[model samples]
Target chain A: MTIGLYAPGASALHRLPAGVKLGALVAASLALFAIPSTIVALAAVPVAFAVYLSTGLGLNRLILELRGPALLLCFVFVFHALAGSVEEGIAAVARFAALILLASAVTLTTPVSEMAALVERLLGPLEPLGVNPAKVGLAIALAIRFVPMIAEEYRQIREAQAARGLDRNLLALVVPLIIRTLKAADDLADAIEARGIET
Target chain B: MTRDVSTRDIVYIALFAALMAAVNLVPPIQVAFLPVPITAATLAVMLAGCLIGAKRGGLAILLFVLLVALGLPLLAGGRGGLSVFFGPTAGFILSWPVGAYVTGWLTEKNWPRMNAVWFFIFSVIGGIGVVYLIGIPWLALVAKLSLFDAAKGSLIFVPGDLVKAIAAAAIAETVRRAYPLMQAAR
Candidate 1:
């Protein structure tokens, strides 16, 4: 809910190692794409939904999770319908939707920290390739942590612009938003340095 | 041009990536004429490139994309997960890092001479042109359309993207004058 699909459940999926879950998602996606049958893809949709339900995240959260994909699925169907046969279009949409559902279920059960740890460990072998997985993981954590705060700032900026009747003025809105964000970053840097984190 | 990345650089990278995600809070405006809705997230991508430099800017976007792939709804319209990589929107999302890198490269190379006009030019070139170059073909393939048709359909994004470019330029200029990190990479 913060910035990830994690639902903080105690399901078997939640207990699985992050790497294994990710690997399984990738394998499942490949398998879905490898199959060419429309009926098979459509039939798999229920199985995908079952995976989500198995996590015990509740129907409401599942619905919320599916909202974005649902809209996009409609768009995909419409485009494919116009360009090709409706049957094929449905197949394409079904395949994509099932894959998304399964992947989302994995994420819904896995924590971000676990994923980061898995990534860092996985990239350990790539140290010879000049890849600093620790730094990358830290960057990812910070990005995830800061996204919600910055989104609140964005919402405030938009509301302020709309209040001033300059909401339509893209420059007016963007300039202030950038200025504020830069200032906040500067302050954050100073705070970090003061805490002796790094220079 | 290569210096050890400091704590500040790390924070900046994270913050810019956060900014990229944050812009999605500003709901996409749907112009009835366009198939693709206009979102401020792309503007933030350009800002990340122009305000930060090539390496950090590109890394920031790469970070964002990675999160999206991990099933974070960081994209506009709350879209996320692995399926996004296989959809029509895949091209633009995949192009983000390269697009940011190109924009940052052009901006930093021309830092001394970079004015609002130059910022606008670079943003247009990297943000729109580069993104479209790859995005159109991918869209064509995914949607089962000809390249020309894909290009034509993309025209609807032009006016809005141009506006975003101008806005990004104005902001980038202000950040340069105030924060002056434009020359950090050099």
Candidate 2:
């Protein structure tokens, strides 16, 4: 859930401009769509993982990070196989895995601060369109920061609900979470205003 | 009221984002009639808007997308990355912020206190329309189907999405009443 990239060392990949890394990801993604060989896409998985490891990022951490999606991929593959050809289904699954790993590498190398700065710079042209680059940058940064926080809060809420015997019911868990989140948002607004971030 | 962002506010934003991501980790609700799985993540997105208003709600979703893009399994069925954005379900992913914005905008405009009819209209036209507008075209492009076919496939989602929207409105209004601070934020 943590959206912040975590690269282990200061390396060339880490030093690269966020825009360049983002561009690389885009180009790689487009190229991935072009190549239909499921085998080649499957091969890219190890290569991407190698890249992550070579950069000093831990393999264990990466696997742990991928566990949730990996499980989801399994379900999708099963569903796809049931619905379509096994060959096509496996191919689709490989493609998805390859894309995720590659994208993760980019994120792992780039810091959130640099990402925000890059986004602001990219939006410079939008100033003429009446857009505020700083605001956009701040929004993106906060979003990145929020990913993990929301996840943790959900865990606590779920536990609380479970203890109260409400975990079995979907509405019981969801309603309280929503209410808590709304309350948090109001507090955030007050904080933002008080900080004079709006001004 | 005119003070800087407290540490608590920062914590709240972080908490909301994380919760949104966690919900994505849950198994999607399987629908017997459709290929698309029903997930509560959309409800979380709507909640973000209702609580944080348009700007931060949009920010929260953007964060969620970034996490997915970064290879976190923080999506329905635990899917993530740019590839997901190009798949059949991509449209729904993209429509998230727009849905949140619509929900927040409607709430801001006094729809929160209205009768069920207006509430239904506000939630549907605003929340569902935003999602469909982005989702339908993307589904068409990915599936290599005609617009009508794509629309038809997506139609299967309408009933479920409507349910989520109403749930969102009800939750939003209830919170607004329970915690006066929510309404006072605006």
Candidate 3:
């Protein structure tokens, strides 16, 4: 559930410009969609993995981190193949894998603070459009940070529900989760106000 | 009227993003008639939009999209990346922000009672329609099918999406009741 990439490295990849990395990621993604070749998409994988390894982020940890999604990706490939042709399925799988690898690299390399700062810088130009660039940037950063926390919260709720012998129905999961989320948001808003973050 | 987003807000956004990604890794529900499997990720998108408002909601989806772009299999049917955007479901994938924006915009409008009618309309027109607009054409192009055929393929999703819209609306209304401060902040 943790979306934050926790690679403890100070490599060059970690030092590259966030904007540049973002641009490259976007460009690579676009290339993936435009290029229909399964082979080319497959080729992007090792190259991405190479970049990951070059970062000195533990390859074993990286692989372990990716294992869950990798398994899921395999399932998708099989499902697609069963649903359609092998070529199309493989192409789909490759494109997906490339995207995952590239994003993991970005998250692993970029710290949250830097990411927030980068977002602020990126959105700075939008202020003229009546958009509060700082607020927007803050919101994005918060969203990134909270994603994992919420996942943990949901898991806790599920576990708690299971302890009570709840059948793990969607309602059982979603209801308590939503209630807790609202409570969390309330506590959060109060804490912010207490800190004078808001007038 | 301006309020600074705090650390907690950031944490909420990140947690929602991760939750969405995690849910997406779950197996998509296979239906006999539809080409695409039904996944709860869209529900997450709607929830993100309803809860986080427009900008953050959109950003949250962007984060999820970026995660997919990074090679995480955090998409419907455990699919991920830019390639999903080129597939038959690409339109829907792209429509996430639009859907969130529309839903958030409607919620922001602050209708009293927050009834199902407004919710249904906004979710269907703004949320679902935007998704189909982007998705149908892409599906048509990729599948090399006629516009009509592509539109037909999208039809399979209508019932399911309607259900999602209703659910999103319900969740949204419930949140509105539970968090009165959310409205005040707005």
Candidate 4:
């Protein structure tokens, strides 16, 4: 459950530019959907797994990333079976699973900063249309920084709820969490302004 | 629009994006009788728009989605990366920014009044209506399920999502009264 985790490695995939990795992902996704052959789709799954292994992150890491999506994959498969298109079900699951694995491989290897830079570069042409690549970069940096802070804040909220013996339902926790988040945002925004940071 | 993005606005946007991440990571709540646990991640998306208003709300969500694509495990249960975009719920996930935009746009219309009823309706329109509009097609056309089948499959989540929409409305009402953002919300 790590965010923007870049597993350092000297593999070929790791050395590839973030833009290329993303571009290839788009192309690969398109091909997966466009080709109707179940065989090719099924074949792609293992190929994706092999590439994931090449990252040297181990089988456990690949499984860890795919754990969330695999349940949905199982659902789609069941849906297809119920609809009497078991073949399509297998193909659909294979297609998605392959894509997830391949993408995780690319993301696991690429640095978050590199990916942010790629987005800024991609948005470079839009500067004339009033897009600020610099601001986008800044926002990305700030979000990355805030992720852990927000997580910590949630921990405190949970602790407070437990102390009060409040029912730890979504509603009970979310309201207080939102209030505090906005409060933090207010102070952080002021601190940023006081520091004289440009937009 | 770009020129108006001050450092303060950027911080709000970034923090909401972080809020989405934080909510996604929070353990899904298990209502005793429900068959499955409900997640607050999507609820956070709804709350983002209602609390921050349209422009910042929309940008906050878009920024969060982009970070997920950058391979951060910021999604629920620590899921992240470009792989998420290829899932069955990809359409719903991708539609979040627009959903937040619509929700924020509606919530800001009667600003300072804190009308919980109207706020609830607006949240439903943006959170449920807009999301289903985009998500259904992704499942029906791209994923090769029948429109009815896809729609039927999605019905299971509607009740829970409605609850989140209601929560968003109530939260907006409370925040307006308690904190007030201390400025023109929009």
Q: Find the 10 residues in a row with the least total lDDT in model 1 chain A.
A: A166-175
Model 1, position A152, has a per-residue lDDT of 81
* Candidate 3 error regions (>4 Å): A1-21, A25-117, A131-133, A163-165, B1-39, B48-74, B77-91, B107-110, B116-121, B138-159, B173-185
Count clashing residue pairs per candidate: 0, 14, 23, 1
Compute the DockQ of candidate 3.
0.20
- Cα-based lDDT at residue A26, candidate 2: 75
Query: What is the C-alpha lDDT profile of model 4 across B142-168, one tens digit per residue?
Result: 667788878988899899888777767
TM-score of 3: 0.63
Q: What local lDDT score does residue B35 receive in model 4, on the 0 to 100 scale? A: 40
Top candidate on DockQ is 4
Give one digit per residue, the lDDT tens place, for model 2 in A1-199: 2443355468677777878878987776677667777787678777766766666677776775577657546654665555556775576667667666766666677665666577678878877776666655554556555545655676777678779976555556566766666566566767777887663
Candidate that would win on TM-score: 4
- What is the C-alpha DockQ of each candidate? 0.45, 0.21, 0.20, 0.60
After TM-score superposition, the amount by which residue B137's alpha carbon in candidate 1 deviates from its true location, in angstroms, is 3.1
lDDT, candidate 2, B147-174, per-residue tens: 7656765686688777776766665565
Q: What tens-digit string does per-residue lDDT give for candidate 3 at B28-89? A: 43333334443556676677666667655666676676556444557654445333543345
Q: Lowest lDDT 10-mer window, candidate 4 chain B?
A: B31-40
**Deviation in Å, model 4, residue A35 alpha carbon:** 2.6
The per-candidate TM-score of the B chain, in the order shown, comes to 0.85, 0.76, 0.77, 0.88
- Deviation of model 3 at B75, angstroms: 3.6
> A62, model 4: CA deviation in Å?
2.6
